[model samples]
Target: MNSLQDALYNWLTIKVVIDERPDDTAAVETEKTFYDMLKDDHSLTNIEVTKDDEMYYVHFDHEGERKKQRFPRELIEVMLNQINQQPERYRNYPI
Candidate 1:
């Protein structure tokens, strides 16, 4: 992968949405799993996870430039998988 893809994969933030269901333990567990896996694997310096009425946002720095990428909250897992398996798919991020 190129430098942009590499940097993004290494440090991008994954904003996850928390479902407001009292019995949605799976969502909570998923959020924790995602956070732990990313932290352990990437050692990111800018991990911001929040749950509000906003869409998913991925923020990162490439070289000396800060960038952001947005995604639907429901696509969190898909987005993460793509980031890991196909970084090229996000070459135009921040556009």
Candidate 2:
């Protein structure tokens, strides 16, 4: 994979692992990885992802103000499907 694809796969892998095992010992490092990926890939800082019953919420700072966005669970599921199809792409992620 190219650098961008590799980075995205790694980031998504970290997100999935954190969601599945929030109490894992690698949580802190995974969070750092997530944040770094957001900054590098999307120019976003202070990023956080959270999920409720139906949506995934992304919170971040933009222009010195806090902003939030919601993504439907189905959209995330589509991304997860793509990730699952190429599991080897994500194998190098820490944790």
Candidate 3:
């Protein structure tokens, strides 16, 4: 993915990778939202959903270089603020 989206997606996770596979990057994540995917999909994001525990740790692999990334709580807050700011995004939409 492009760097901008990468920068955004990076700010949400825990652990290097849910499942370290040979075919995949060492840091991996599930396909579902972090809230649901925490337990069933992958071992990541197992922390309780609180303001204190919002910060997440993740791993990124770009150009064969794998590095650790910390998804700060601030980024999450920004997202939350964005969602809160845009009421239209959720109007009549599935929760």
Candidate 4:
């Protein structure tokens, strides 16, 4: 299934925004885990995690210099699977 969307997802900046609960540590940790995995392995950039008030945003810069993209996970599973498959593709993005 080499659809264009799948290919785009490979090189897209994925931004995930999630609501927080009283104890959001696990959620934050999970997001961090994803970011670290992507950063160390793939060419993804700007993998940032930010929290404001009651919301959290995890954003990564897209894979190419000519184009920048942000990806919000439709669900955690799909995004993680994509990231896992091409882990080495997400590293050292040019500034």
> TM-score per candidate, in order?
0.39, 0.47, 0.32, 0.35
Where does candidate 2 have its weakest 10-residue lDDT segment?
1-10
* Consecutive 10-residue window with the lowest summed lDDT within model 4: 13-22
Tens digits of per-residue lDDT, candidate 1, 49-92, equal 33345555666443455566664554445544655476475343
- Per-residue lDDT over 31-88 for candidate 4, one digit per residue giving the tens place of the 0 to 100 score: 4654555655555566545545544344556565433333444442354455457758
Q: Which lDDT tens digits does candidate 2 get at residues 1-95? A: 23543544456555665565455546448667756766766566676668799886778776687887766676556644655687576443444
Residue 37 accuracy (lDDT) in model 1: 55
> Model 2: how large is the Cα RMSD against the reference?
6.5
lDDT of 2: 0.61
| Per-residue C-alpha lDDT of model 3 across residues 35-78, encoded as one tens digit per residue | 24333333333232222475655554434554455556666455
Q: Cα miss at 71, model 1 (Å)?
A: 2.1
Which segments of model 3 are wrong by more than 4 Å? 1-36, 44-46, 52-71
lDDT of 3: 0.39
Q: Candidate 3: which pairs clash?
A: none
* Model 1: CA > 4 A from native: 1-19, 49-55, 60-67, 72-95
Error of 3 at 63 (Å): 30
